[model samples]
Target: MLIANYLLTCGILQANAASGMAVHDDCKLKFLELKAKRTYRYIIYKIEEKQKQVVVEKLGEPANGYEDFTASLPADECRYAVYDFDFVTEENCQKSRIFFIAWSPDTSRVRSKMIYASSKDRFKRELDGIQVELQATDPTEMGLDVFKSRVN
Candidate 1:
């Protein structure tokens, strides 16, 4: 009887650990969606783990003009606009930000990154491709910025 009780307790603990890992995994997926939507020209993503925020840094001084954008994400089943940025740059310059998600005890450290595209159309297309890739990915193969180029 004692052995049976010990086994049962271990099983319950394992189940709770599994639950926590699932929650963390979901958070990572949500963060990825947010990152893909934010990609644009003259910007890159720098993921920071310490603070739970995405920092949008300007790529030097804007030479020509600034373009504004609003990025939305689903949080708690309701859509929220997480970022509104007035992005400025020269013809081929760039910017970057780190999108941080809190650490979970059950899962390894996870974060998301956004890369700005030089061409608006190309950025949109890249984002679309990222969406497709996310849909088809399993947990083993998920990675950040796989389809994006780093700014020079």
Candidate 2:
């Protein structure tokens, strides 16, 4: 519940850095929270030590179980209460897990999506489609389309 409340208050700030490779301080802090919460089902993170940056995308599901975390933040639609974690490996390999759990203002259940062991270059390449989708409304989600419009 604390994590959900924290995420609601800090969601907007995290969205700002979502599009860019740069890490947000609040997001970094969330990592600490997640690290402590990882027990069985909440444990979703990856590490890649050979890339220039590490990235993690969030799911739109509840934080209680794997089946509950299957929501993928839709390509361009901006959903409230979206949260994820990002961290760089010791060698800067760019390995980390990301989950996005969608919720209503009341924190009601919604879909959630997740990904792990993603490298910077590979993720960006894959994000090309996501960028195209975000362009219509969530231009900020793509970070200048660094991955380009290859998806379309």
Candidate 3:
């Protein structure tokens, strides 16, 4: 009876740990979605932990010229500048690919930037496509003049 109770308690603890991770991941994804919404129209279709990615299906065209819009922002307001570009997925011939310019939360300078896509295939495809451009950049690294020249 004691052994049974101990096993049951362990099971409950494990379940609680898993639940906590899920809740934490959900909150992070929701925060990213909110940040994306501030600059562009986005719909978060899925968030997968195993995949280690968030899949956002863009709802409509970007509100303003992508570069100009990001460039015009005040440094302290956003955590990351997210950009969406086009790509061809196997399931859907063409889809939007999202990337993030991770910022230092206080300074808002680019820490790094990366393709925040759904899967490996999409990430590879984006890299392969020569014409694909970064739709977002650090306002500090590339000023408005340089950012304008790089936009697609």
Best by lDDT: 3
Per-residue alpha-carbon lDDT of candidate 3 for residues 100-129, written as tens digits (9 for 90 to 100):
333333443221111122122333232222
Q: Write the per-residue lDDT of candidate 1 for residues 1-152, one digit (tens) a residue.
A: 45435534755222222212212232333344545654332232222223322233322122312222111121111111122123234565454443211111223221111111111123223222232222111222212332132111
Better of 1 and 3 by TM-score: 3
TM-score of each: 0.20, 0.24, 0.28
Q: What is the C-alpha lDDT profile of model 2 across 30-137, one tens digit per residue? A: 444554453222322222223323334352233444224323333423232222333455566653343322222222122111111112234333321111212222
Model 3 lDDT at residue 58: 32
Cα lDDT computed for each candidate against the true fold: 0.26, 0.31, 0.36
In model 3, pairs of residues that clash are none
> Candidates 1 and 2: which is better by TM-score?
2
lDDT of 2: 0.31
Best by TM-score: 3
Off by over 4 Å in 1: 1-20, 24-28, 39-93, 101-152
